[model samples]
Target: MKNILLILIFTSMAWGETPHDGMHHTHEEHVHEKFVDGKKLEVDPERFDKFIMDLKDTQIAIVNVQGMVCDFCARGIEKIFKKDINVKKIDVDLSKGKVLIAYNVAHEIIFEDIRDKILMNGQNAIDMQVIDL
Candidate 1:
């Protein structure tokens, strides 16, 4: 068992799959970390839209934002949105200049508060629309 473990460790290191801060990093995670604009945890746009299309008793808001030029901006927006207890999923698409937020129906947050959350992140939220699903 010890020899197998040692061999696996060496193989992982040789393959650039070393543990990061004691956590195993997946290939996708490594790609995201190395590429500044790929930090968002989202499926492809088409798949995302379809996934949101059938959700019941949920609030989906798509916000057009300005000043989201980097990964930090995207992550900052995510952190701010997560403050709302009901926000279940967050997807930031810097390429589209949009932030997609989904919250539970039982605790829908006011639009003004959602806008405030975006604005508080030093981002200019141009507009937001609630998508019915």
Candidate 2:
């Protein structure tokens, strides 16, 4: 058993798969780590969309945001959107670098205001299109 363990260790080191190997750096050590370590979980796109659409009837707008690095950046945008009482949901598509904002009608919020809010979070909102209900 001991020999087997030693052999496995030697092989891992030889192949640069061990913790001390060249590419074994912890994610936290990365300079541009966009997500918190161990928090890079992914959700199914269908489920995420369904969750967002469940919001109360209001205005839904899809905004294309450029240069979103990761979920952390998306969460930052979400936080900003949440500050508005009219906001119902904020869905981010990091793959395409966009955010879908759903607002409650009670507040009569407009697209320009949503765009400004997104930009205020340090993301560039390239375009906004209302989702046809």
lDDT digits (tens) for residues 1-133 of candidate 1: 9999999998886532111111111122231123233334223457456647657777666666777789875787888778767887888877777777777866654556766777687766665555434
Q: Per model, state how many residue pairs clash.
A: 0, 0
lDDT of each: 0.61, 0.58
CA-RMSD of model 1 = 15.9
| Best of the candidates, lDDT | 1
| Model 2 stretches astray by more than 4 angstroms | 1-49, 106-109
Residue range 10-62, candidate 2, lDDT tens digits: 88865321111111111222222222344332333464457555665555565
In TM-score terms, candidate 2 sits at 0.56
Clashing pairs in 2: none
Residue-level lDDT for 123 in candidate 2? 66
Clashes of 2: 0
